[model samples]
Target: MRAEWVLSSLSQALLCVDGEGTINYLNAAAEQLLNCDHHTVLGLPLESALPLRSDKGEALKPALLNELASAGGEVKLRTSGIDGREAVMSLKVEVVRGDGGEPAGFVLLLASHATASSAAAEVINHLDPLTSLMGRREFERRIDNLVNDAATSSRSHALLYIDIDQFKLINDTSGHGAGDNLIKAVGECLSAELFAGDLLYRLGGDEFGVLLCNVDSFEAKATATRLVRAVKRMDFVWSNISHRVSISVGVVLIDQYTLERQAVMSQADVAMYTAKENGRGRVHLYDVHDKNLSRLHDEMDWVHRINQALSKNEFCLVNEGIVPLGDNARADACRHSELLVRMCYKGELLSPGQFMPAAERFGLMPQIDRWVVQAVFDYLIANPQLRAGEVMFSVNISGQSLCQESFLEFVYRNLRRGNVDPSLICFEITETVAITNFSVVTRFMERVHELGGLFALDDFGTGMSSFGYLQELAVDFVKIDGLFVHDIDKNPIHEAMVRSINDISHVLGKKTIAEFVESQVVHDKLAAMGVDFSQGYLHGRPVALIHGAGQ
Candidate 1:
């Protein structure tokens, strides 16, 4: 009775048959697998519940079952499915002896062909030919099981996504044969370092997945770090040329909160990409509270929101005036106001701080930039007096939008359609954006200048190559970074830095605008440094382009 109870609890299907080949009992697994009720099948012929056939596709006779009980050996049989399909199942038959040492009954242990192939395959499936580790299919199956178990019970696990860094360079410089050898070597090395309950899977070329059971965030992070170091230390030699290999690992904790297998794996993949982006050969933990990940999730939500906003015209344009500082004739001639964008949500005005980060991260900036430009152009056309006043509206453009060929065409088309003078509009590109895409930005600036539009390198002195690229980019204005101007009056170092930037801008024949000028002291200091313009709360806050524009 105890043995029968144990069999009933087994995940694999089990059955007890009498000496006459009549079914006596069926476990829960057997009932589910065969799609029959145990009470209904009891005392029935074994063949009635599961129509078993020999491996050769012939029906198994009673004599064969009796012989198998007598000999006590396993047999492979084919079972008929509900849809008339055949599925291979393995039957390990054990004979039960009576007191007189005669055959009494048989205990059958049943399993699917894939799970019963070999001892190793029982734990996994379809081991990789080269690495001898479990393949992608088995990995996915195990992850599904983990997810299901987590839904029922409280347990924690962690998944590590490992990707070889600069793997393509090795393949391109050497050959495919070398790449194959390196893969095998790395797989072997990693497999050797795994713990007892851990599993390593080769998830296709140059990528692997490690399922670490019963581990928390700290342990998982430590394991990931060790794995990274181990990969970096691997001595890979191909064709007498030594190759160094490193891996980026993304770690994500799995628990009841984990939505599903696909979502968990996607989280790991995102963390891995973050590691690669932050300079490879590192481990990144998937923190729900992380600003970037939070922004990422918010970005996905905002993608739809932004599209809806554009269609429904939920966006508003505002402007902040840039006041002249010092006795500069050019500053007096240039009437500048920076155009800012805001979104209307739930009957309240949402500043750029709330949604622009999401837009930038999710590549929705181009669409938003186009909307801003079109709206600005429309406003200028409606208020011809503003255009005739020679007011230069410095509209900020995203780096992504500025890099696209279509954006330039869009700008030109809108200018022509609005019949607005290009000189009255100045596009603002950040210093970092200008420096990162120097050549592209240079060409863009030249084209804009040809169209009579001016360019301003915004947030100056923030990028590493700001000074170098400043000489290359053709712009009319340079806005000093707010960080330098925020406390320039109190901090001598900041004051000196602002002075240096101001002097350099004058040398380059560009007008300087000091940002974050919140007081008369900061504004006066900038004026003392010959800064051409000042913008902040001290000058004026951003107001709607058209008055009485409320959400």
Candidate 2:
């Protein structure tokens, strides 16, 4: 027991392999020393955990293990993780004997400074521990240096983003061990194709980045095509089960025109997705002029910006008034407005029209919606003036958020935690979203109504058969779609649709708000038609939520 405790306590990694060469025990330090967990390797053959190889990249021979009984062998340790880079380790093996003086098993002790070895630490920092690839950090740094290098030299380079096709299938069907083996094999296959001065790195899960040095567009495309075919030709066998694997390649040329490291990476990623979209196991060379790739590139750019906006507290709230149309507009309506979100990005306040489509496309709307909700809740807690039930703040939610099962809990928790006036908040979702996710939306709205909160269906008249949807949804307000409202005066069909929606909503005990009420003509027209409220330029423009509209 004491010996076991001592073995467990040792800072250096240790492993015990039975005479049959199966690992029976491993210390905690061994996990970190090799960047591995015991659940995958314990009770398995030592080679399953450590596929040791030599300087020539040949598998360590079985004869070497038998020789370790007398004079121990030294070999570099390898345990592939995400990156699969390895470091040199000093291995000393001692044979354990049974009472009959026969070999029971072997105790392999690690003797070296894991942290104290400067050479190992340097390799660990830059090279991936599982395979020979450099790693993502080094890949980025090298790109930056290479971009700067392009200014002085006339040599061209290219960035290729390689992604394993259907990698998740391997993990799901066979196991993660097979997935790891596939990664190692793919790395080897790719490395075999590298030219002198070319670099490769494991960019991330099932993805690799290759920096092809001294290659023009023609040469770059040729090389990328070769990479795609090479992976297709690889006959990867894991655990005696052969699995077919292929990779999609996206290539972006690097020249004097190359701007920054991130943009280059983004382009490569976009191109890779393009290849995958077309069909897996192909190559797509990025062309800035291609409309589809260009649009995807822009969205990728927004994805980065949106991530930054969330982390940096760059999102701010604004409100546009929703004033009643009749003579008693002020007394009946109070200070009602719909909350709008703006991003203070890169020294410019960008409206939702600028960034929202991208956010929705990339499934970032749920995160943005949460940020708005928490911000509004926290803001009300901080300021007493915004707490009154008279001032209702309507917030827009996206369909992606409605699909999330925990989103309702998140909203409920914040509302309960802050003790903010429930009636002062109104949640809004597009008519399309509310219709598609009808069941979840109904449950969410019913809960809000139960809490004395309100629900609004925004952009109401755009859908083909929305009147029927209105009959089922217990929404407190319906904001006529801006597409209809913006040209309501000029388009009689739009005006009639607006009037019909307004009358139906009133019959259902719900108020109606006309969006895009740009001119007095439209406002007066809405008033004459008995629209309950107006929200747009004519009534009021949006102002920062911290300061209320000047009544």
TM-score against native, each model: 0.53, 0.65
Top TM-score model: 2
Candidate 2 CA-lDDT value: 0.80
Candidate 1 stretches greater than 4 Å from native: 1-146, 153-270, 281-316, 325-335, 342-389, 398-420, 461-472, 483-508, 521-530, 545-551
Q: What is the lDDT of residue 342 in candidate 2?
A: 99
- Looking at model 1, residue 302 earns an lDDT score of 69
Q: Return the top candidate by lDDT.
A: 1
How much is the lDDT of residue 174 in candidate 1? 92
Q: Candidate 2 on 244-340: residue-level lDDT in tens?
A: 8889999998888888897788889899988987889999999999999988888878988999999998999987888888764845847788888
Clashing pairs in 2: 80-130, 84-130, 84-131, 85-128, 85-129, 85-130, 85-131, 86-129
Per-residue lDDT tens digits for candidate 1, residues 1-551, read 24553454345778888888788887766876677777788988776666888787765445676666667656788988889998988877777779999888777788777767774645544688778888898888778766654564466778999998888678767988888888888888788778866789999999999988666899999999998988889999998999989999999998889889988877887798788879999999999888887655555566668778888999998889888877863537657788899998888888998888868865689999999998888777776666534578889989989777788789977766648888889899999888878888888788778878888889998899778878878999999999999998789998888899889988999989888889998988888788998999997789888833311
